[model samples]
Target: MSQSETPSLYASRVPVFPRRVDGFFRRMKWWIMIVTLGIYYLTPWIRWDRGPDLPNQAVLLDLANRRFYFFWIEIWPHEFYFVAGLLVMAGLGLFLFTSALGRVWCGYTCPQTVWTDLFILTERWIDGDRNARVRLWKAPWSLKKARLRLTKYVVWALIGLATGGAWVFYFADAPTLLVDLVTGQAHPVAYTTMAILTFTTVFMGGIAREQVCIYACPWPRIQAAMMDEDTITIGYRDWRGEPRGKHRKAEGSDNLGDCIDCNACVNVCPMGIDIRDGQQLECITCGLCIDACDDVMAKIGKPRGLIDYFALQDEAAERAGAPPTQIWRHIFRPRTIVYTSLWSLVGVALVVALFVRPELELTVAAVRNPTYVTLSDGTVRNAYEVRLRNKHGDERPFRITLTGDPALRVTLEGTPYEAVSVPAQEMVLQRVYVTAPPGSDPAEGARTEFRFWVTDMTNGERAHQDTHFVGRGED
Candidate 1:
């Protein structure tokens, strides 16, 4: 092929200026944005009384201490499975919603959509709505353009900084961290994390905008597999809208649908794709186009629903002059039932595990260096490192015992058996020694198994670990 015949590899981005529209769906988006942003920014500041010995931040990931606190629940490092289970349930929940409602998460709850909506609102306020913004983009740089651009970018940067700053509060005490940050005494990691998050939030929310949803987010591509014919999504009724022309019905044009070809749907779309083109991955199913078209239809005296929430099967039925399917039937189908059941089961299991899990844990590791020694008294001796955890809010006493060998006795660092005092919600590490009388363990060179048990003295709850007692060989 000649040089001119080959297409260029790069495609320049086309800017999308979504015109402002008001109706039910637009109001819903506004409420969702306010509620979600409130939760994200305010949750770290809420206080919980976890007693004087524990951190009071309601939602905290205490990484240095390897503990997670969420209101009344505290998760130690050993209980990470609870976190994993919650994540699994979250994924299943996404599947359930997508299978039933179609792109609802992307439309209403996605961080990208929420932040992009926020950035666009700021842009519209500063630079003027759709037509003015488009004109400004096409116009060459000037003092007015420079001023608007500068102001808009500064505001976006501030929002990004706030988003990043709010995130760090989840890892530390919010009040203390705020003071340290203002005084420039916070840890370097805090600054580094905030910087990285700020950069991403600004780029993804303000500059990238819809490009992140179109090219970066995998949900739009993956959602197709989850949606079926019965799944409801925002759609253009081409059967009732096509054969497009301007005021075709007023002109008494034959075989023409109700559509006036005014382009209101395309004008209000954030993704810059025509919804009439049908089921593109770029569409977030935001339903802004529905709001826009509905207003236009109401003014033009045509029955509403030129664009509306419609299942794929309902489209065919409507095209064939049949009534559309009921919305509830669309929601409670077999696929959605299965997904909902799986999600609910995972949530229930996590709740049960949280209630029934033991409050104390014990671990024992046999010392491997030289394995065992034969005392001068002809007894077999083995060493171990014992760790005990007290999960309660107050300090507790525990007694350690040895079992599995009648002739075996346990001691702590050569002292007689005594109760180990473990600090509240803390672990105690100590050295332990186990000795067995001569001929009690096994024949020379053999190993005998035993148990190290720690019983909480207050409640009599016990946690035990299995270990082996090693004996020396004799020639």
Candidate 2:
């Protein structure tokens, strides 16, 4: 291909080397990363005394048993609505934060940001800070560069492996699974899951970095809709930063802004975009630029907040020679209020449902192979598969009874009229037969509605399922 005919789609990738900066936001980010990573890696090892019958891991999704155990709460498969409710609350919380804080979750707590920050920290520790890294990138292949690059990649792979390993612990008994994994006796699914997560972590954090935020993640696009003028975002004070110069007292620059054009903010930005260019969708609002600019402002004997959390509305006010709005006013806006209320209501409702739900459950399925059968005495027998679930923590007996038809007689196939004993936190499927005595015949082509009631003998708790009984033509 000719030089003029180069494909427009073939764009080269550029590397970002963010310099280290120290300030309030930097310190906060350090603490948040520490806490979040600690929780992610260590939570599965934390033990809660869930008794001998249940797994002691504080938070576990026991797929084998179809149960979710979280600290003191144990959720059955039938109670999946609780998990769904939590997801809804998470979405609402994101909306609430975005409405008031402007992509704060993406900046501080998102997994992509957190892992990428960790990866960058590793790169800086092995290679050097921004200037050194830039030099290394431009330098030709050498033994020193090769050694440093190898060491950095090894450390990154280790971090990714640890991240993937930690995630698998949440699905099983952590200590046993760890032993199995180390001894090469774990399930293939476990190994496969770890491999996939490790690849994603390394690829996304080490290789992709800001590309995931810019071209991959949907939150950046959706956040624009969530943000309004009152949203607090990391913004440059352009009203005071315009007419930029290297020195405030340059020739014919008496009216220059306080900005010295040090490029510190740009050098420290992970997204490789200037905040002075105004708000861009690529920016994660990580606030590193704020720290860099604040440090510069401090060194130059100027007041801080040259690049700070400032609302766009306040930008207009500041340009009009008025003070910016208060932080509390910016926080308590209408959208945030609505989102908070919705999140809180869902949480409360889930809590209530969890506490009020029955400890026993019943489901009945009538056999349709032949629909109905006639016995020697001309009685109609309807066979059904009844499932009884014991949600209590101990094995218990439940009395099975039928209602909606006084003439219907119920009998368990194996143990005829005996109470069914269900193991703790388990379900039992039993074959049952409901027979209508000969003289109790109903009209032809009629279906009789009945209820299968299961009452826990230990606690007197009860649950019922309504089903229909098929019958032959009327006598």
Candidate 3:
């Protein structure tokens, strides 16, 4: 191909200036934004009294201590299954919502969507509405434009800083960290994390905006697999609004469809796609188009729902002059039911595990380098490492004993007592020795299965770990 005929791989993005529209869905978006942002910013500050030994923060990751605390619930490092269960539940929930409502997550509660909406609101307040913004964009550089741009950028940066600041609080005590941060006494990692998050938040939510949804986010593309003919998604009723024209009183005005081709839906779309063109990948299904179209329909004395939430199945029935399928039937289909069931199952399992777990935990590992040693007295001896974990707020003594064989005796290294005191909310590692007297059944056998029982002296709570006691024949 000639140089002029060559196609460029990169195309500059056309900036989108979504006009403000007010209706049910827009109000819903405002409420959702307030609630989600409120939760994210305020959760780390909530206090929960977890005694003197543990953190009092209601929600904390406690990365340094390898623990996660949420109000009354505490998850230790070894109990990572709880975190995994929560992640699985999140995934299932996304699938469930996508299968039922089609990208509602992206349209409303997603961090990108919420933050972008906030940035847009800030922009609109500073630079005026859609027409004004367009004029400003086309005009050359000036003092007034520069001032407005600088002010908008400063506000966006502050918002980004707050977002990053709130995130770091999740991993540490919010009040203490805030003081340290202000005083420049916080850790370097904390500062580094905050800086990175701030930059990303500003770039993605403010500058990138709808481009992030189109190019960065995978959800818009992946949502197709989750949705089916029964899924209710934002769409235009081309059958009702076809043969669109601006002239309402032309020669064939009676034959013209209800659509006035005013471009109201396109103007209000955050993703900058014409919904009347049919289902496009760029559409976030934010329902702003529905609001815009409904307003126009009301003004023109036409029925509403020119652009609305509907399923493919509903389209066929509506075109055939029949009532559309009920909304409940679309949401309660098989795919969504399975996703909801899995999500609930994981949630229930996590809750059950949290309640049933023992406050005292025990783990035993046999020393393998020299598994079995034959003493001068011809007795079989096995060395093992025992870890005792005390989840309680107070320190407690734990008594260790051998459960399977009466002939086997257990002793703690460097101490003569069978019971050891473990610190509160801590794990203590103790070297243990198991011995079988000469000519005992365990001493002569190749291996004897045994259990190490650790009993809490204070509350009588017991935890046990099963292992094999290697004998002389194993060598």
Candidate 4:
């Protein structure tokens, strides 16, 4: 092929300037953006009175201490099952939403979508609407363009920084961290994380926008598996709006469909694709196109719903002059019901586990180097390392005891008593010696299985760990 005739391997990106539109879905988007952003930025500042010893932040991931605090609930490192269960519930919830309403999460609640919408709003405020943005794009570089561009970029950067700042606050005491960050006294990791998140938020939400949803995200491809014919998704009714024409009073206009080919739907689409071309991966099902088309239909004196949330199963029935299926039937079907049940099951299980867990925990490991030591006093001694965990907010005395043989005696290495005081929200290790009287049956036996129990003196909560108590074997 000639050099000129050879097609270019790459196609440059076409910037999309979505036109501003006002309707039911538009208002819904506005409200959702406000609620989600408000929750994200303000949650870290909500103080929970979790005693003076514990963190005061309502929602915090105390990585250094290996604890997760959410309001009244505190999760220890060993209780990671709660986090795993929550992740499972999140997956199930996503599946349920996708099965019921295709890409609803992507459209409204996805962080990418929400931030992109915010950026677009900022851009619209700084630079006029769609047509003005298009004109500015095409016009030669000027001081006016530079001023608008610089202003928009500055605003986007500030929003990105705030997003990053809010995320870091979840990992520490918000007020303390904020002060440290401002004074340059915070850890380097904190600054590094915030910088990375800031860059990504600006690049993905402000610059990449639709490209992130169409390419960077895996959900759009995976969504096909979750969706079915019954899934309600935004779609164009080509059956009713075909043979599109603009002229209404012309001779051939009588045969024309409701669509005037005005491209209002396409103009308002953030993804910048024609919805009338049928379902595409780029479509987020945001319903902005629906709002745009409905407005156009109302103005043209035609019935609405040229573009609307539709189920593929209803296409044949509607084409044959039957009324569309009820939305409830599509949403409450077996697939979505199963997903909802699983999600709720996981959530309930996590709550039960969180409430019923013991406040005191014990773990014991036998020191096996010499197995059993023959003490100078003619006693068989088995040493063990025991860890006592106190989950309460205040220090509590824990009474240690063993269950196996009545002849066996337990003693902590440094202390003469069987009780040790564990600090609040801390685990303490101590050397424990289990001894049997020299002439007892347990002293001569090769091994005796026993459980070490730690009882909290304050609340009587108990935890136990099982281990083997070695003895002198018979020759």
For each candidate in turn, the TM-score is 0.95, 0.94, 0.96, 0.98
Answer with 1 or 2, whichever has the higher lDDT.
1
lDDT of 4: 0.92
Query: Candidate 3 local accuracy as lDDT?
Result: 0.93
Q: Report lDDT per candidate.
A: 0.91, 0.89, 0.93, 0.92
Work out candidate 3's RMSD over C-alphas. 1.7
lDDT of 4 at 70: 89
Error of 2 at 239 (Å): 1.5
Per-residue lDDT over 1-475 for candidate 2, one digit per residue giving the tens place of the 0 to 100 score: 6577656986778999999988888899999999999999999999998655878899999999899999989888878999999999999999999999998998999999999999999999999999999999999999999999999998988999999999999999999999999999999999999999999999999999999998999999899899999999989998887778886666867788878889999999988999989999988888999899988888878898989998999999999999999999999978888999999999999989988887788888989888888889888888999999887778999888889878888899889565889988889999998888776743134688889888888989888999977777633
In model 3, which range of ten residues has the least summed lDDT? Answer: 1-10
In model 1, which residue pairs have backbone atoms overlapping below 3 Å? Answer: none
Across residues 1-475, which tens digit of lDDT does each residue of candidate 3 receive?
6577678899898999999999999999999999999999999999999888678999999989999998888899889898899999999999999899999999999999999999999999999999999999999999999999999999999999999999999999999999999999999999999999999999999999998989888988899999999999988888898889778878988888899999999999999999988899998899999999999999999999999999999999989999998899999978888998999999999989989999998888889888899999998999999999999998999999978888899999989999999999999999999999999989988999989899999988888989988887776
Stretches of candidate 4 above 4 Å error? 1-6
TM-score for candidate 4, residues paired by index: 0.98
Report the CA-based lDDT of candidate 2 relative to the real structure: 0.89
| Model 3 spans with C-alpha error above 4 angstroms | 1-4
Tens digits of per-residue lDDT, candidate 4, 1-475, equal 6576778898889999999999999899999999999999999999998676888999999999999998889889898999899889989999999999999999999999999999999999999999999999999999999999999999999999999999999999999999999999999999998999999999999999999998889999999999999999988888899889999999989898999999999999999999999999999999999999999999999999999998998887788889999999999999999999899889988888988888888888889887888889889998999998888888899999999789988999889999999989999998999999897877988878888888888878888888887788732
- TM-score of candidate 2 against the unseen true structure: 0.94
lDDT of 1 at 174: 99
Ten-residue region with minimum lDDT total, candidate 1: 439-448
Pairs of residues at least 3 apart in sequence or in different chains that clash in candidate 4: none
The runs of at least 3 residues in candidate 2 whose Cα sits more than 4 Å from the true structure, single-residue gaps closed, are 1-9, 441-445, 470-475
